[model samples]
Target chain A: MSLVEVTGLTKVFRRPVKDPGFRGALRHLVSPRYRDVTAVERVDLRIEPGEAVAYVGPNGAGKSTTVKLLTGIIVPTSGEVRVAGLSPHRDRIANARQVGVLFGQRSQLWWDLPVRESFTLLRDMYGVPDSLYRARMKRFDEVLDLGSILPVVARKLSLGQRMRADLAAALLHGPRIAYLDEPTIGLDIAVRDRVREFLRQLRDEGTTIMLTTHDLGDIEDVCERLVIIDRGRVIYDGSLAAVKDDFARERRIHLQLASPVPLASLSDRLPDAVVVAGDEPGEFTVTVDRFRQTAGAVISAVLPLAEVVELRIDEPAIEDVIRKVYAGELRLA
Target chain B: MMEYEADFWLLVLAGLLQQLVGLAFLGAVFAQVQALHGWTFTEAVLLYGFASFVFGMSPLFFDGLWRTAWLVNQGDLDYALVRPYPVMLQVSGSYVGLQGAGDVVVATCMIGWALSRADISWSPLTVLVGAVLLVSAVTIRVSVLAASCAISFWLQAPHSGFAFAINQLGTLGRYPLTIFGVALRGVLTVVIPFAFTAYFPVSWLLDPGRYWWAAIVTPLVAAYSLILGVRIYHRGVRRYESAGH
Candidate 1:
């Protein structure tokens, strides 16, 4: 059976429609107006057990709204959302026991208390057994290095260290599913890698994961399935490789040669491959169809004419693909 | 069911120290003369004990009243609304301030000394009655402050306003409500109801007023404010601007 089954999921928020200024405000005091803001509209998605799916979208693209609906933070306007065969809104306590959620910008840890105290509070709040809590704490220390940071208050930790502790706090309940909204935002590269590694381990242990982030590297390294939304609707849902390749038939290979070369001279050598763009010396951005020429074939062909010191692959970034999806150009892969 | 002895001690000690200063201030004036009220200096000690005990108990058990502003700013109140327990109960138990427990012990010690000099009699049944009324008074004060926090969520005013008002109410709460005229008396009884939280309940148990029902009605009145506070909280959540929303 599927761990999560969401069909025709929709959410609408009624926002106030009052105009600005004192006169408009005075008029609203007597009788207020309202506007309909469709946060998540008609989104159909399904996830089987242990699937690590990434939900991505631009700002105001209904990504966070969809998450609130799924986690039972807000009630949906219409349609059904089920996790582990229960409506999240109807059986929130029972459902909350089975799932864990963490919002990166907002913390679940107590602000004034030490991180270790917050973890102890959660142990009782979630009814975690003493043996299991101890076991999980040891494992978290190994994975996240939580020992040094445990004594520090949450308000004192850097954004990176805080995210690590929050990850451990969320998983101590032994939930079957986890939702992370931008868990790596505003963190250094090393911290981001550790968080991604921790997530990979969680996924390997058969935990269904749902993630939303603007970082393309996070998408590439951690997520298996992809769902893209734009302006309150799902635009594409498929594998990560499929989403990356869906936008173009060819990949761009950028070449960095050792010496400066004339643009016309480089273009003439590889007539089929265009010298589309490049600015630096010893660098040429070449566009070629992978079907027609292999990267090695192009490298062998270009190495003779120019002194090739380094070579690099230039595939379209996940950001560019999402921009197009927001523009209503891309479809399900 | 929840006995927070560690938190309770911290508050009780703090309350005792603050009341000791009040005791000294009154003693300095009375040293020149004899008695200001009907009773001697010892009776004044009993009133101070009663005031500090009620104040410390309310803050120690229901310290989350101070944190409502944090919840409002952070949008954490939404988590409380979806739970099964009473919203006010959840708000009160969410935090436990240790300092307030320290004050409670001081108040208890003063009460013992007051009984030694003051011409007062205490039976088991009367003591039990007074203790019950004191418990009700704590609930009333907590609910009033919580209601103040609840209403400000919609006003978008900084939580500082409600906090100042709570402290002001508790400050005025230290005095006997009957010494004031009809206007302030009515306001304390109807508009804010701080008198019920401290003055009326304690006085009824101490003097055994004909209005003994005030002790019974204290919790009931607080329950009304709690219901209204919850209504305001739920209404605010529907309009709350959550993080990055």
Candidate 2:
């Protein structure tokens, strides 16, 4: 059985409709109006144990709303969600024990309290045994380097430091499933690498993780599967490699020639590839479908026209596939 | 918290000074008249002190209710909802108002002085009954404040406006019920029951022969307010939709 199952889940947010100006405000007080906004519409998902899935989407695409519903922070408008065979909203306490959640845009730490104090409070709230709590803290300190910032107040910590502390707090109870929403957002390359490494380790330990992020680096480092949502609907769901193979099949090869070559000459020579001018007069680029033509074949075809001084081939990345989907340049079934 | 020790004490002192000024105003009124409305000067002081005492106890324990609006508006309550414990208890325990220490101290002094001036005979039975009434009064006061603050879930504001307005009603409990009109009297007794926290309990203590039933019914009022507060908070939480999309 899947560890997490959501079927036909939906959430409609009702917002009050008010006109402009003071007179409109007064009139609204006398007769109020509201408009219904459907944030999530009949979305279905399933996650097996020990699987790391990346949930990605544009802003206002209901990614956060779905996380809230799965964590029991907000009730769903319709359909069902079950974590560990229990409904999250109806069996909140039981579900809480099974899942750990982290929201990168928001910190769960107590604003007025120190990081250590917040962890201790969370320990007591989750009823974690003292010995197990100490062990978990030690492990987190070793991997996340949490010792230096333990005594610092939450409001005083840097963004990177806070994310590390929040990660420790969320995983304190050793939950089986973890939900991380934008865990590496707004961090330097070094900090982002550290967070990604920690997530990779967590996933290796058999913890099922659902990660939502815009940074494709995080997905490449940690998740095996990719789920792309647009306008509150899941447009693409498949393996990361499959997404790259299916939608990102084109490869670009740039060649720095010893002498200038006409773009039309190269295009005529390599009819299977699209040839375009590069940055300099002596440079040319050839774009080819990897399955249809090989880089060596394109290079052989180009070498006869101009002396090749240097050349570089670029493979299509997951980012290119996702960008195409977002721009509506490619549609996935 | 340790770093803010001085500010905490200063707040407590400010609370004490406010209550002292109120007591001074009560003293000036007594000097001009023998009684306000069939109650002696000492009897009125007792009612005022009891009301202050109960009102002060609320902040010491349940001060987090004051932040309900901020929590709901900012979507901060999301963490509390996912925890294992009851959300209400977690919310109420989130903060502690040290200023309540000053209110408690001033109220104790005022009640002691009034007991000495009033003409009541002391006994073990009276002491036990008074303790129960005091407990009941504080319970009722805290429960009412909590219930009022729970309205924030529906109002969706960043401050507890309803709770503040209801807190202002505590001023009415500082005087004898006889001075108010029949409608106001019924309101203080039945509608919100501010009288149970001050007037009724104090009236029964000063003259048991006439108002012994007030002391007996205090526990029932406390229980009713507690149930009402918990129910309203649960319903409010169910209606809670987080702040932003």
Candidate 3:
């Protein structure tokens, strides 16, 4: 059964849409300027139970807007949205009890309070029993390494730590569905991987997860399905690997050297791999088109130049694909 | 089991410390005036203390007013709505003004100083009336702001307009309502009635000889503002569209 369903979900922002200049600003205050910016237009989607789907899009592409609508923070201007067979907007309270949400840019935790206090507050707000709360915290600590940061105040925690705590808070109620918006945004790769690992566990436990992120690694690591939204509409909804194979037809190879090497010289040696920026002379990046050549072919071409202490192949990242989709190069089929 | 005991007590404890600081400031002023304006220093002190108490108590107890604008801006209210608790209670618990403590102690000291210097002591009846009226005054005052921010869900920029309007109303309540003259006072007493929150009740509590109706006005104003504020809030929620989506 589909745990989440939406049909023709449209949201229009009337606050910011205005004619240009000071004259328009003055006129707006008097007549109440309204702009009909269709944030989510005719968005139709369905997610079956226990599905781990990645929802990715460009900036201002209404990814957050869609999450807000799904979580019932804002009422929809038009359309119907249901979570666990409940209208998220109409029965927002009930829907909330069944779903956990985390937005990376902002935290729901109290700034002055310790991380544990935040989790406790959420436990109360969600009406979870103490035994279950303890059990969930124990699981989260094991999965996300939450114990190391639990004693710190929310404002004091690093962005990565705060995001991890937020994830735990969202799940304290044992929600059936989870929504994570940019959960790894602005974090180091190690931190991102830690959060991703926790998410994978949630998916394996049969929890339906709807994740929105610019980090392609998050999708590649946890989600099997991909739902790409562009210009307020879902352009592609299918297997993550298929999306990767389709628009992301390029790969990147990195070469780390034992000795310092000049950029100009490396560029002359490995023309196939563009010297993408790196720290010091030890690292250089080479982007290769899979359509033109393969990873093995690129590796053989670059192996002789650098001692090749470490070599990594970068999959076509979703960030580029999402950017392309927004640029109108990759359209939904 | 579903209680934010830590948040709750911390708010109260913080407010208590803040109120003491305010009281100490006012205490310095009292040593010089002996009396302020007309009444003995204690009566003036009592009025000031009472006002502080209400300010501190309202924010500490009913945090929704101070935080509604912020919550609405961030769409944090959405979190409250999804939870099974009453939306109002959730918002009230979201944040309390840390400065509330300063206001609380000053108010109590003012009232106590006034009682000490009063030529004639406050009768127990007058004390009873003052207590009831003070509680009512806090309710009405907070209700006005809560209603203001609740409408903020629709207003594009509500913070300045809200602060200005509430403070303007405060000018009526903070000083004697009679200072504004009969016509101005009438507008406050009837149209806005923020004047009643402090002035009418204070006059009735301290100068019972001059204002007998003040005793009756306390309960009436509290009941009116609270009911109206909540009603206005519910109406605004219906008009509320979510941020962005």
Quote the chain B TM-score of every prediction. 0.77, 0.96, 0.78
Sequence-dependent TM-score of model 2:
0.94
The CAPRI class of candidate 2 is medium
lDDT of 2 by residue, A10-54 (tens): 999898888999988898899999999998888999999999999
lDDT of 3 at B173: 59
Give the lDDT of residue A246 in candidate 1: 61
**Candidate 2 residues B107-194, lDDT tens each?**
9888999999999978898899899999999888888888999999889989887899988887798888888899989988898889
Tens-place lDDT per residue, model 1, A88-137, is 77676777788888777767777778899889877887789999999999
Give the poorly placed runs of model 3, Cα more than 4 Å off. A15-34, A239-327, B1-49, B62-64, B70-94, B113-131, B174-176, B202-217, B234-245
List, residue by residue over A18-60, the lDDT tens digit for candidate 3.
5689987888767774657889999999999999999988788
lDDT of 3 by residue, B1-245 (tens): 11456665576577667656655665687688665456555555566566666666776667655566666665666556656666777777666665465456556666676667765446788778877998898888778767876767666343636744764565345554544677877877787777767767776766688788888877888898899988887666545554544
Q: What's the C-alpha lDDT at position B5 in model 1? A: 62
lDDT of 3 at A59: 81
- lDDT string for model 1 (B12-81, tens) is 5666667778778768867975764443466656666776777777667778866666666776754453
TM of each candidate vs. truth: 0.77, 0.94, 0.74
Query: Which parts of model 2 have CA positions greater than 4 angstroms off?
Result: A259-265, A300-307, B117-125
